[model samples]
Target: MQTILSVSELSKTYDSRFQALKRINLDIRRGEIFALLGPNGAGKTTLISIICGIVKASEGSVRVDGHDIVADYRAARAMIGLVPQELTTDAFESVWATVSFSRGLFGKPANPAHIEKVLRDLSLWEKKDNKIITLSGGMKRRLLIAKALSHEPEILFLDEPTAGVDVNLRRDMWQLVRSLQASGVTIILTTHYIDEAEEMADRIGVISKGELILVDDKAELMRKLGKKQMTLQLQTPLPLLPPALAAYQLELASDGNELIYTFDAQGERTGIVALLEDLNDAGIVFKDLHTTQSSLEDIFVSLMKEAK
Candidate 1:
């Protein structure tokens, strides 16, 4: 894949001597949905701001489509659209007017048809004439997206796009994002919702304490970090784990009525068959058994903890 954006040795610091980001390096591929996951104050927004020319980096460089963000800011910024985390828009401005104004700001020639199409895609056409203050929280979010896309940017940045959104609205946004990707727009989103990344992103990047921790294809990330567990509900309540089963490293739970076995999901063999045979040799009988795969949230939590 082609690189759409690149950040090298990026760092940000305030006059108060507090560092917001530190030596971060990242490359975003064109036409990919790359999700950035991090906890609050983890520098997700600061990174986005630097890339979008909103905030100046204290050190290093950012290039959008090979144009330096600071030196060639106009052209670079013209190629990117940012839907900010906050919903700060002209209260009395009509949706259509505000969206049109945003396009004009980018020095794009007036194109009403394009504006209409963007609004319709965001489900904001019906509210195009409504004042920004009159729209619901969800509608306002959609409007923000419409405005960001007004200039037909090659790359789009969504900062917590689904925060505080209802289920239906969230699904609608997901579908809209897919449509944007289908239109060949590269998307980089910062999200706290693990499921959102799992469901939408092709690549996942974990950032913590201003450092980039890991970046991998979504499926590979899940497989590398994901685990599986088997729970056996035993028919007999053994006083403790059998010495013979010690090699399996299984845990005795539910007062010895259950045995828990954890294994790597990516392992060649889960060792279930051998464990079951050993259980039989020990005269351990299971009344029930079930297995479960770990979710993205579990993997993300484990990674963050390790980073800390």
Candidate 2:
């Protein structure tokens, strides 16, 4: 796992006396899908923009594949391709022409064979000659991806890649992302879809209020912060929790017909045995019980709230 991109003490400040990014430091591993999750204006896009040379950092340094982004701009930028959230293609230009032109923008030699392969991989080969305005929204999204791959960049940035797409198209894009990773592309994903990050990212980075709050392997992050809840369906509704079960701090739900207990999933002991024993002593009976583990969305929301 080589470090392909490194950001050290990076900061961005606008002229309006607002800080968009706050001393951010991150290292993107080679060939890994890293999902950057955050709320609107959480600096996800700002960070990506800086790394892709679209925005200048007010302080600190960034190196892409050992090339300083500022001093060696061309070399650093040449290794990266960006698929912006917006669809800003030439409406009158054919798909082939737009994609071909993108490759040339990076100062790369014309490789028609590579361009054809990218189009074919994105299922845009048949529509290569079609004008951009004539394509469907889904096709246009795929064409954006094709343009990003046109330059054969080592790193690809997908900024809200599936923003307005349908479920099926989102799934297709997920598969395409996986294929790109398989082809040895380091992908930086900025997405509002938590489930997409949970499904596609090898590692997750959560940012809030211009700060990188957490970065961890997806599974590890879940297991470390995830909580579990046990819901017990009571045989009879109670007006209130018994004094004897006060230590458990359980909540009454469904108008007292249900009891809910929340605990850390990684805790050494859940205290369920003692809880049930006390419940029986209080003449409380549950007909059924079920448990649910916290999801990434739950963790993400909790993190954001805590950051606030």
- Give RMSD to native, each candidate: 1.2, 1.8
TM-score for each of the candidates: 0.97, 0.94
| Candidate 2 total steric clashes | 0
lDDT of 1 by residue, 92-195 (tens): 99999999999999989999999999888888899889999999999999988998999999999999999999999999999999989999999999999999
Lowest lDDT 10-residue stretch of candidate 1? 262-271
> Residue-wise lDDT of candidate 2 within 133-170, one digit each (tens)?
99999999999999999999999999999999999999
After the best TM-score superposition of candidate 1, give how far the Cα of residue 304 lies from its true spot, in angstroms.
Answer: 2.1
Q: 306 in model 2: Cα distance from truth in Å? A: 2.0
> Looking at candidate 1, what is the lDDT of residue 133?
96
